[model samples]
Target: MSVDRDTVLKIARLSRIKLEDERVEPLMGELNNILAWVEQLDGVDTTDVAPMTSAVETSLAWREDQVSDGECAEDVLKNAPVSEYGFFAVPKVIE
Candidate 1:
């Protein structure tokens, strides 16, 4: 697949990029080159290859599923400018 002039402009608008008229042609060529390289990758044989999530094989460590407060509420409240009833206190913003 290749990108045309209109596609480049549409991409710029979708991305909120302020692309100049002079830059559209160059950007179109760059995008087309990228798509062409990706298309070339589709020609490779991956039938025997196994899908992998990471370059280096590793397993996550098992852990017990438990929930508990971090037990640092007092420590955390010390940093607050104003705290009350075991919680941070802020000025009321609405009536």
Candidate 2:
């Protein structure tokens, strides 16, 4: 799959990037090279290979879910610039 100048320009426009007319040719060539490499990878056999997230298999260590000490409403509202009814207060938005 070869990328032409028009395709490059269209891609640049879609990506919201402004590319100069002279830069289009080089970008097209680079994109085409990448596509050719992907095409080459299509010839490889991977029927026996298993999909993996990482090269080594490992399990994530996890801690037991247990609740401990928690802050009271007064403690939480102590640092607020404006608080009422044990909650942070902000300016009213609607009339």
Candidate 3:
């Protein structure tokens, strides 16, 4: 794959960046070099390689699923400026 000057200009326009006429050639050269480097990866043989989700091999340590409240309602309500019943009270927002 190769990037031409026109392609570079199109990319700049799509990204909402202003590319000066003199800078287009330099950007085009850079894009072409990046594309060539990426193309080189296609030559690597991966037929026998197994797919992997992470570079480091390790099993996740998971805990048993459970549901429980903090059981400290009185302790938490003490910090509220104005608590009503068992909940925090705030200014009425609607008419």
Candidate 4:
């Protein structure tokens, strides 16, 4: 999984990054080192490890699902500059 100079240049081009020719060699080495570290992670044994969504173990509080008007339409309409028929009113833009 070592990164070559051409591969580095191709990646830079695809990403639309303006990488200089002189910087390509150094970037290639850095990318290769990162890939080597990731490859090392494959050797770890995880047969007993359970996949988890979060590191902390916790349960969400359950609530009954009920549908109702929030009853705050009047409160919200107060902020509008002009409201008509229980809704916000704006100048018609379409001709």
Candidate 4 TM-score, C-alpha based: 0.47
Model 4, position 95, has a per-residue lDDT of 85
lDDT for model 4 comes to 0.89
Specify the poorest-scoring 10-residue window by lDDT in model 3: 62-71
Model 4: per-residue Cα lDDT over 1-95, one tens digit each: 77898899899999999997899999988999889988987898989988788878888888779865687889999989999999999999898
In candidate 2, which residue ranges exceed 4 Å CA deviation? 13-16, 61-95
Show the colliding residue pairs in model 3: none
Model 4 segments more than 4 A misplaced: 47-95
TM-score of each: 0.50, 0.47, 0.46, 0.47
Q: Is candidate 1 or candidate 3 better by TM-score?
A: 1
Query: How many clashes show up in model 1?
Result: 0
- Output the better candidate (2/4) by lDDT: 4
What ranges in model 1 sit over 4 Å off?
A: 48-50, 60-95
Per-residue CA lDDT of candidate 3, range 50-71, in tens?
Answer: 8889988899988778856688
